[model samples]
Target: MKKLALAAGVAVSLVLGVQPGSALAAPTSVVLAASQASWDQKLAVAVKFGLGDDFALVELPDRDFVIGIWDHVKDDPEHVEVRVAAETAFAAAPEDTDQLSYEFIITEVYAAFDRDVERERQEAEAKRQSDLARSAAAASIDVVADAALLNGSDADFVRLIWERVADDAKWPKVKAAARAARDGADSDRTAFIAAGMAAAARQDIDDRIAADEAKTEAEKALERARASKKLAANRIGMPVTDELLNLPDRDFIIRVWNFTPDGSEVQAAAIAATRSLDPVVWKAYIDTGLHAAVERDIQIALERKYQADRALAQQIKATATKNKDLNLVYWTDKALAGTPTQLDDFLRAGQYDLDLSTSFGAGEVLPSWSNTVAWTGGIVNVKPICCTLTGPELGVRNEPGHTGSTSLMYSGLDNNTTKSYAYLKSMALSRITVKSSTRLSYWIYPQSNTVRPEVKPANSTCVAIDLLFSDGKNLRDSLLKDTKGNRAHPAFQCNKVTVGKWNEIVVPLGALAGKKVTTLVVGYDQPGNTGGYRGLIDDIKIAD
Candidate 1:
């Protein structure tokens, strides 16, 4: 009869599509299955007959059925509360049919799930806060490290480190070590940052245990000795080694003495410190004396450079005067009269770009000889029948002048005048006087192409100058030679003239040194050419 009832309940559950708490119309069809029925058959009858709240207990004899339910709902998103509760109950008694019952699955599973969810939320929030705190701590550590490196004061740096990490629980060992160094002697603070803080930080990361604090006095003294040797070696670019670190105090000082340049301040200090044979002296020299000596050495080197620069400036000034480059002379004078920086500037580039001809001294300007009309003498002579001088007018041009607002230009056309000659002469200047030491200097710009001649004593420069005297004598017959050693009568010839650039002509009155000047003349004589011609002149001065 139990088997028949169980089969009939399963059949009714399948046909009616009923759930666990549905109402049934026929009481006979809804009869409860017997105790020996399988759990699925009992569940089917409970669903078909709506016996969820019945007083009689449904016998779930097989524990696998509840285990299957737990496995199915454990990962079901819609049954999170039931899944967690079921997990809890299964953990407590996985094989106990009483705890695995449907009644416990609906009630305790949801309550346990809620509690676990809240616990996970709190843990996630705590981890986020910890990450943020670590980030902030890292930034603060960077700032403090930068300040320490720049300040160069080990004691103050250690104190700052202590204050920064004092309340930070993550760096407990670092904080303690920094505090001890902060309140200790200056050497203690220096030693801490040099090595102690790094070791403490490593220990804190590995395990939060107190560091060893039982260093013997002798051991501390030995550490200080090694650190001092290393610091000195590093400062002087000497390699630090175990043998160097273990040297006797005097021998160590001797090593530093040898490492420095002979006769250097550091070497002298090292020798003095070594003579004392005292550890305190050695420490003091390493800590402060070496730095002071190095500074003194630098000042000495700078003083030597200053002296050398002054000597060089004097030499340059003399050379500038010899070259007759007044621009260079002016700049050198400024350098001599100003600071060392100005002297360096003059040597570097200031003297190279300025016009040397514009600044003249020991000279006299003749206002009557200022323009082209004073020198042209109203004469334009052109040779050869085919040659014609189209223009010989004098005008002022703004550029290509040696000095002043405008230069005197004399222009004319050749008109196919091959092997022709043209000349311009100055009117008589009987009012001007010449002395034995008199010298005439002027600059000229020739606007023509210069060609080398195939044959002939005369080159193709086509330019010359002559000085006339009161005795009707010219420069060619006189003993006067221009600064270039060429006779003043034929100044520009044989590559001596530069075309398209200003050229200076200086004539010293050698034979006619103390005579009155009659006239000044300029000429063009190209042996085998014909074209337009132009030239500029400026800054006519007489010097001695």
Candidate 2:
């Protein structure tokens, strides 16, 4: 079914970010007080503050309500901090007529409020340490003493030592001789003394630098850890207690919540997203805070999912709509369509309808009976059941219209005793007087391994359909490629049977010759193949 749609890209944007002044940006206290108001009112507030997409409900395993905001602002850490602070504060505030009362603030709220503040404090500590390192480097050198050392020292070390001596005016040195001794001592002791000073100073400075680096690094690591933790915590899992991702399984995802004592809002959101996701199994990523201030935000996320699914469905629908010749959407539970198979009905999400519906042999009992439809794509598969033998009739063969050749292989073909008797039945070859534009179509799907007498392959046996027709004498058989019989048409090809969904078979009327008198047959045929290799058949149509 097609839906009246909004641009999918726009809907996705809304889920990713909440605009300024949107409801998501509102002080938690304000939202708590006004939650009783209509959804439109809250949405207006969200848009006003540009926080519509930033907020969502955080469900506790024990079923408690908590609000979560995407407070990761790269350039505006302050704003992020402020929002967290407001949400924390509002949690503690008592509801007033239009806002939360100041006196209602509590210890728990204060603890949450301090979270952002602590982050800032950690960041500030990092900045302070960086500044300290720069200051230490700048203060270590003396310019004037350095200049004197250049002229006085015999070596570069001499200059450095002399500068130290010059700084010590109380040193006992007499005029030129004192300068000479100092200069001489400058070279001799310079290396040893300078090495000692550097070693000593660097010990303390290195420690400070290391501490600062560690603090900054630790803060960054913490931020990353926090984000990873939040992502894990916020994930929406399939509502089913078992593994929902398992392929080829029919399941359902249901989301039940409390929204407006009546739970209507929760129901609406679930219906919308479910229709959009249209998953094989019923899996629900539910926000339990249906009555909370964040319900609207949850709805936004669901709406986004819906729009995405709608866009994809619309594309598939367009293929059908544009091709008016496709008057039907053949539906079936079989993973892949086989020849000689029948098509059932389809479920529409919004618009368009299915003309036929079908169920395969066995295991059809698990289907859902809700007003909604069940279509599992990923999890369901077709498993092949091997040959088995039972007592009785031993072997009996029924062949359709081959005259003597039909009964020739009677003894060669086995019923596999344990399995039901197998036979081929083609539509009676009746001649039509005139060439009419006719469409021959059918739907087919794969069956499960639990089902008996499916294709075993090892015995060169698998279920297949063969369609043969002739306009006068010009004869065309089931797509030669898909037919399991002779290799008359090499170019004709179809996928080898595996676990998958059903597909449709359509032959345009133009493919047939204009001459009258013809024959048509739909049935399974085994050339050299034997044993119980049979395919299921249902709904067959020939329409003009």
Give one digit per residue, the lDDT tens place, for model 1 in 1-544. Answer: 3433443343333222222242211112223222343555545534432444422323433222233344444445444434433322222211222443444444444443453464355446534433332222223233323534434456666776787788877678888888898889976775565446644654464343223246666765676666556555654556678999899877887998988899988899999998895778978887567656755775675566567667766765664343232334555677778876576555444433222222122232221222232121122333222225343434445644686556655554444333344445432232234666677787877665332122122222445555444333355445456788765543234357676678888887645654444345455544344455566667765445
Task: After superposing candidate 1 on the true structure, give the runs of residues whose Cα lies further than 4 Å from its correct spot.
Answer: 1-225, 336-544
Model 1 C-alpha RMSD to native: 44.8
lDDT of 1 at 158: 72
RMSD of each: 44.8, 32.2
Top-TM-score structure, candidate number: 1
**Candidate with maximal lDDT:** 1
Q: How do the residues 40-95 of candidate 2 rate in per-residue lDDT, one tens digit apiece?
A: 43333334335455333211100011121212221254444333223222222121
Listed in order, each prediction's TM-score against the native is 0.30, 0.20
**Which parts of model 2 have CA positions greater than 4 angstroms off?**
1-423, 429-437, 453-500, 515-519, 526-531
